[model samples]
Target: MTETDVVVIGGGATGVGVARDLAMRGVDVVLCERGGLGAGTTGRSHGLLHSGARYATADPEGAAECIRESRVLRDIAGEAVERTGGLFVQLPDDDPAAFDARIEACRDVGVPTETLSADAARETEPELASDVRRAFRVPDGVIYPSRLVAATAESARQHGADVRPNAPVTDIVVTEGTVTAVETDAERIEADHVVNAGGAWAGRIAELAGVEVPMAPTMGVMVAVDVGGVDSVVNRCRPPDDGDIVVPHVDRVVLGTTSTPVEDPEEFSTDEAAVEAMLSEGAAMVPAVADADVVDVYWGVRPLYAGDDGGRGRDASRGFQVHDHDVARLTTVTGGKLTTYRLMAEAVSDAVCERLGVTEPCRTADAELPAGDAEKLDALVEEFDAAGPADTDIVG
Candidate 1:
């Protein structure tokens, strides 16, 4: 059995971020993942760096957190983020009064938003339909999830953290209310602290430690199109709904998404109906998308805690919760959006350090992640571009 100061479950962004943060603070950490790193929700998102504009109307707090983290992430992971900005458009039937409130809300949170006329909006994005009633630009960007996860893992490795992929924790060894070790198929690793950051599988991990996590998993589907229809991220200035946002990533634009509640996280499938629904709704925002060539389709699961009203998935608070199982020496950090993952990690690391009596303050905010070699990145892009099909490994 290998002994470490902390054993982190889940190889998604949250888990890898926690591992990197703890290891940077000089804690001996081991991160175990059942599959490849970021082979979960982290890689399946719409890849938009939330400018906080999306949640400005409904959830102000969540919106604020997103804006703050957006700046930090842009500074740290320059290579993974494309500062393309975002456009929130209102159609003929859309309410302008609500759009005003959204713009005001964004201003309150220090997010710069400017209203654009129909012609001006078209000037910015020629592909936009002529019926665009109102348009506003916010400082939004796109994030490459796979690159972000790989960077965090590299940072953890640089700090002497051990990362084991394809190693699933089968059980949590507890003795008299204290977590002593984590048993995986390959080995049994002992730890003084355990953090469950498994995205969709968080509940199962907690159950292994004899604890219950009220998580309601929902699957989201996103389809990518070959046509370079839009340059900036386009969002419908309305409440969260299916296929409301189109994010341009690298060489193509990703049109997403569908929020259908599901029982099993790993068992859901992205069918033709879901794809057709996304494309139809997506075409409303950008008319050219109607004829765009569909390249690939993927799905993601959001782990939302079951609420009092039985609201699941996007209906639940975009906020996160941190549970400190003191007696068990375990901490579970779940929920929250992908844009604020760094802050989530900071909070989780702080809790773990406090439990272990360590007084180190987190410096993850200002830390700059190591970037991939420029030549290597360019070569990878060239290979994907020349591979004939746009669906080739351009993302990973």
Candidate 2:
């Protein structure tokens, strides 16, 4: 039986990030995924590198975390990040009070903002709907999910972590309330500790260890369309709602999304009206999308913590929590945004290191990652088949 200091379940951003962080800190780690790297929530997101303005008013602490991590990513991830800047446009039909509150909250959360007049907003983004009354710019940008994941996995490997893709974890062996080993399709790994960084599948992973972790997953759809002249990420200035965001790529804008809780993250269905509303509501903000050619339609299930449920799935907190299962030596991390993935990994690695008696402070935020070279990054992505619907056009 092969042995590892720790076994990380899930090959998504958080799992790979944790592997990279732990490996960098001189810990032995083995990361396994059921599918290709990123193929989960990490690869399926709209790829927004949030400046935290989206949640500045509703979740100040989380918003603050996002802004801090946003800077870290922009600094370390290099070419993987596009500094497109973002706009929160207020329609004439929207609440002016909400716009003022957003400005106040952004200041409170340290999310920089600059208000732009209608003409100025139009000038900056010609494709912005003519009726867009006013807009504010923030430091939001875009992240290539597959590219970032490939770079992170590559970093983990360079740091001595074994990152295995398409190695589905089939079982977790618990002996007297302690996790002793993990069995994957590839092989059984004897591990001193196991981290369930399974994204939406965290609860199921916990179950394999005779532990329970409540997760309320919600499915949201993102539609990518080929359009021209849009250069910035555009978000509705009002409270979050369906089709409230339009994230730009080189040739398409990814319009998203609707949140509705599902019992099974793997078994949720999509709504046609919601898809139609994406084009309709997105068109309201950037009219050019009304006739844009559809490029792709994909969905991601949010790995929300059930304990934080506030009735409506949308009300569920975007904050994440690290759970130490009753089964000793098992930790489950759930609920977090891709923008703050590195921070989440640091937290999990810290927890694991403390248990292992390793005293290495996290340096992932400061040290630049590998895969800055587009060719190298794309090679790793192709090697792992990491391309997902979000960046299908870019890689492969």
**For residues 145-254, what per-residue lDDT tens digits would candidate 1 score against the true structure?**
76677777778888999988778899999999999999999889999999999987898899998898878878877888866747899999887888899888655678
Error of 1 at 319 (Å): 1.3
Model 1: colliding residue pairs = none
Error of 1 at 162 (Å): 0.6
Cα lDDT tens digits for candidate 2, 1-396: 689999999999999999999999999999999999998898999999999999999999999999999999999997678889999999989999999999999999999999999999999999999999999999999999999999999999999999899999999999988899999886799999999999999999999999888888999999999897788999999888989999998889999999989999898778888889999999999998999898899999999988834443888879989988777999999999999999999999999999999998999999998857888888989887788887777664
Q: Which stretches of candidate 1 lie over 4 Å from their true place?
A: 269-271, 372-396
Q: TM-score of model 1 relative to the true fold? A: 0.94
- Superposition error at 391 for model 2 (Å): 1.2
In candidate 2, position 196 carries an lDDT of: 96
Least accurate 10 contiguous residues by lDDT in model 1: 383-392
